[model samples]
Target: MLDKVKELNEKFKTASPQEVLEYFLKTYKGKIALSSSFGAEDQVLTDMILKQDKSAKIFTLDTGRLPYETYSVMDNTNLKYNIKVDVYFPDAKEVETLYKEQGINGFYESIENRKRCCFVRKIAPLQRALQGLNIWITGLRASQSITREAMHLVEYDENNKVIKLNPLLLWSEEDVWDYIKTHKVPYNKLHDHGYPSIGCAPCTRAIKEGKDIRSGRWWWENPEHKECGLHKK
Candidate 1:
């Protein structure tokens, strides 16, 4: 599987994102799906994927703490595409246990607590969502953060035991916005308010003009520890 991933990376290194999607969507058929967060990059991919295959699977993890704007764009994307995106949520019992163990926002106290929160709210749900899938598509870009710099166009996610595909891995922030504008794709309103990265409401914020794109997400943590375990390598 690792060798296959390596081969795919080589094969599509020079291919456009649409070309990559075209091959994988057909090859994997019902086995491939995109996990969207309704962000700009994801929105662009959604447009591309739906244009190619309206019945393509696209799902999102609703952490129950997402910002209103995230939900707003989710609705707009559904309306624009005329498709109901599948939604996955954390286990109710796990969420209850998490709150009991860590109050309302204990993630603010320590990195350990934050990771635990992410596990309950995002990672665990993501695990469930990825079940029965051979390929997991994402909107990750290398320039978004220090953690993502080493990512490839296609790689095996040993943790999830699935082939992880990052269609927009090489896209620039400018490239993403250009595609968004050119296509008139529906996007989160928070992007207009300086939010380069959006996540659960409490874990996200708006960054200043020159800050790192991911700085707005989990702003309280060091760059190396900013990830919420969803994309952990």
Candidate 2:
């Protein structure tokens, strides 16, 4: 399976982003869905999917901590695309348990607490998002983080039991912006202020001029503790 995954990745690495999306749309028999955080890359994908198939399932995780601008972008995307974005929330029980145990400020204490918060807020909902899906699309690129540097354009996600397709993995940041500009894709207003990757407001910040892409995320933590662990697949 590993060898097959490598072979598929090699093929996908050279495929055009359009071709990849088209292939997945048919390969998954239109059962495929995309998760968008409304970042630049995500907006670009939303545009592409809307253009290709208006009925495509586009969804977001309402982690309850996103910026106001993020929600604004989400609203604009829906208005522009004339499509409904299904939203998923963390389980009620898990959220209640965590809030009771650590309070709302749990993540600020330690890496373990942060992971626990992310698990309840992200990983669990993400699993629910992929249920009964054959292909899951993302806005991830290789340059985003060290852990993601090892990622391929197409890989099997054992964690979610689905085929993971990162259509933009080979595309550069300039490439994403170019498409967005040419297509007039709706994007987060905060991007103009230096936010390349936008997640929850509290967990993300603007990057310095020379900081690594992952540096802006969880900036207070050591290099080895960067990932939120929800992307482990």
Candidate 3:
């Protein structure tokens, strides 16, 4: 797996995202799946996956705190693709306990509190959704963050014990939008409000121009440490 990752990276160093996706589809077959948050980049990738293989499984973490538009897209995607998007929800007991003790806004107090919220709402559900999958697809790009800057089109995810293929690793924000427009893909309407990255509703908002892609996400924290821990190694 490591040798194949190294081989594909050097071979597709200059290849477009479409090329990388083609390679992934050819390689993994049904053992692979795409995890999306239904943002523009995600919708772009989803369109590509459907074009390549309509049987490609797509899933998302609900987080139980998403915007109404995200929920609408989930339903819209089902009707558009004529396929079911498996929704992963948090552990019921954990969520119940968290809400009972700390209330909903506890995440604003500290990083620990935030991680706990993420664990229940996103991470735990993500882990459940990944079980039995040999490959995991995502829409992450290098330009999104310094952490993702060193990423490749294909890499092994030791955490999930699977091959993590980021087919759009090298795409820019403009590239994603262009693809979406060209394909007429369905997307959330919040992008026009300076929200380059979208997530659960309460914890996300838009940022000013010239800011980073993830600056609006978990913005109250030190910039270097604002990740939701889902994509963290």
lDDT on C-alpha atoms for all candidate structures: 0.94, 0.84, 0.86
For residues 49-126, what per-residue lDDT tens digits would candidate 3 score against the true structure? 888888888999988899888888788888898888888999899999998867889999889989889989998999
- Give the winner by TM-score: 1
C-alpha RMSD of each candidate structure in angstroms:
0.6, 1.5, 1.4
Model 2, stretches more than 4 Å misplaced? 1-4
Candidate 2 structure quality by residue, lDDT tens digits, 141-164: 988777788788878888877777
Tens-digit per-residue lDDT, 1-233, candidate 1: 97898899999999999999999999999999999999999999999999999999999999999999999999999999999999999999999998999999999999999999999989999999999999999999999998999999998888999999999999999999999999999999999999999999999999999999999888888999989998876
Q: Ten-residue segment with the worst summed lDDT in candidate 1?
A: 224-233
- Stretches off by above 4 angstroms in model 3 are none
Ten residues in a row with the worst lDDT in model 2?
22-31
Each prediction's TM-score versus the true structure: 0.99, 0.94, 0.94
Alpha carbon RMSD to native, model 3: 1.4
